[model samples]
Target: MSDLPLDQVRTLLAVVDEQSFDRAAAVLHVTPSAVSQRVKALEQRLGRVLILRTKPVRLTGSGQVVVRFARQLTRLEEDTRAELGLVGAAEPVTLPIAVNADSLATWFLPALAAVPAVGSAPAVAFDLHSEDQDHTATLLREGLVMAAVTSAPNPVQGCTSARLGRMRYRAVASPAFVARWLTDRPLPEALPAAPAVLFGRKDELQDRFLRGLTRRGATGVRHFVPSSESFVDAVAAGLGWGMVPELQHRADELVDLAPDHPADVPLYWQQWKLDSPALATVAAAVVAAAATALRQ
Candidate 1:
């Protein structure tokens, strides 16, 4: 077993976080040479190069492992300090989490809000990475975030996965839009010719829904609205029909294109397998909120 020193591990994370040895040195209050030496020594001990000597230092495959370890170590240490009442000089705990845009625009905020404020503990702040649920697991795998709301059921390496629940999407359009394009036509035929709003190119919910019904892709007047909150607004404004998350679907203004064909995307919460109290608290709160917001 490589008995890597804690200081060396911490230095590697600092360099990666700051994105350069010079900036890492500034953060660590050490000379640049010292920061480089520590990272180099850690690489040597681990028998692999941890960083790429780029303008802004990039983490190598090996470096991601070290950085993830360092962050988890830091998290546990801070949690320990708070538990032992020795957190007089500790910084606030900043959790970098990955979540899909739909959840971010909906129930996920409430999940964060449900986390009870821990008095005398380190103040918690969230660095949320808004990504698609289908690809959010990559952020966790790359060590970019500690946890994620991902579509994958399998946990990332060194992480734990819990089924959050299913986010149901309703195919909706404005009443005017439906009357113009969908009222007299078959859904499969009308949907392909009608305008559609998509979150992004990777957003396949609409395409999948169309293909499943018609074996054809969505190729109509498409508007790419990237923001989740604005995506529903676009659909509501009669710009296009879209698969709106049940949480964001404005029922009174919007009419369902196909109420029987709602898409239920099963979301999972993946987090690093750590014993940090704050992470546990956040995970529990997220699960609880998801249970209420999503279909069981």
Candidate 2:
């Protein structure tokens, strides 16, 4: 394939970020017509529609690919400049990463803090996007993040994956909740109708546990607590039972409903395949932290 024009690709990314050709032009110090022309020329060259010019512009599938290429190009450019001492020493490189809420609440930030600057490498800043581990890879696939902590072992396209470890979760409820709801019958019979706390609409751990036990899903009122800390607080305050991660579990406030069974979610680190030192340093720190924080 022929080479992609750097100016055109960068212009497409600018429009996507700014959401309007006029806004992009303002940022690029060019006319709106020039921005529009660049994007049109890119589309014509690729023989595909790159964008949908909506109120807020939207990227087509091909547009997403080009934007990803543009970001990677930018990353490489910054790395090269930093290595060559062309970038200002005071400026730190910012890496956008996607991580699940649980890991962020527990061990993720510490890992970032522990990352040591490689010889003469620029300092780094993190722009973290918190999502469910099951869905974090979507950010990587959409080019929203350079790296992600995900549950999927398979890598996203243009990325490489490594096994991080397992996050162990136990079915837990407050003693008050158990006395009020679980005393009626065997767990299998009582749990189906009992109130339960969910992390979010995307969370399936509680349902998965229920299905494994009773061959059915929870039928009672579902309480949605989206934040990791609040999810534990909700469960502890007798709002509902939930699958609580081992690191976040409190023996004083929460009781293990199923002491014998636990849900172990396998976590993976996924990042772009580029040989970037900043990315490598962060990835290594994360892997080291997970080694101690998660189940082997």
State each model's C-alpha RMSD to the native.
2.7, 2.1
Q: Give lDDT per model, in order.
A: 0.88, 0.90
Q: Specify the poorest-scoring 10-residue window by lDDT in model 1.
A: 114-123
> Candidate 1, clashing residue pairs?
none
Q: How many backbone clashes does candidate 1 have?
A: 0
* Candidate 1 Cα misplacement greater than 4 A, ranges: 18-26, 29-41, 44-47, 53-58, 88-90, 117-122
Q: What TM-score does candidate 2 reach? A: 0.92
- Put down candidate 1 lDDT per residue, 62-150, tens digits, no spaces: 88887888888888888887788776544567788999999999899988876755323456778899999999998888777899999
**Model 2 Cα shift for residue 118 (angstroms):** 5.8
Highest TM-score scorer: 2
Q: What is the lDDT of candidate 2?
A: 0.90
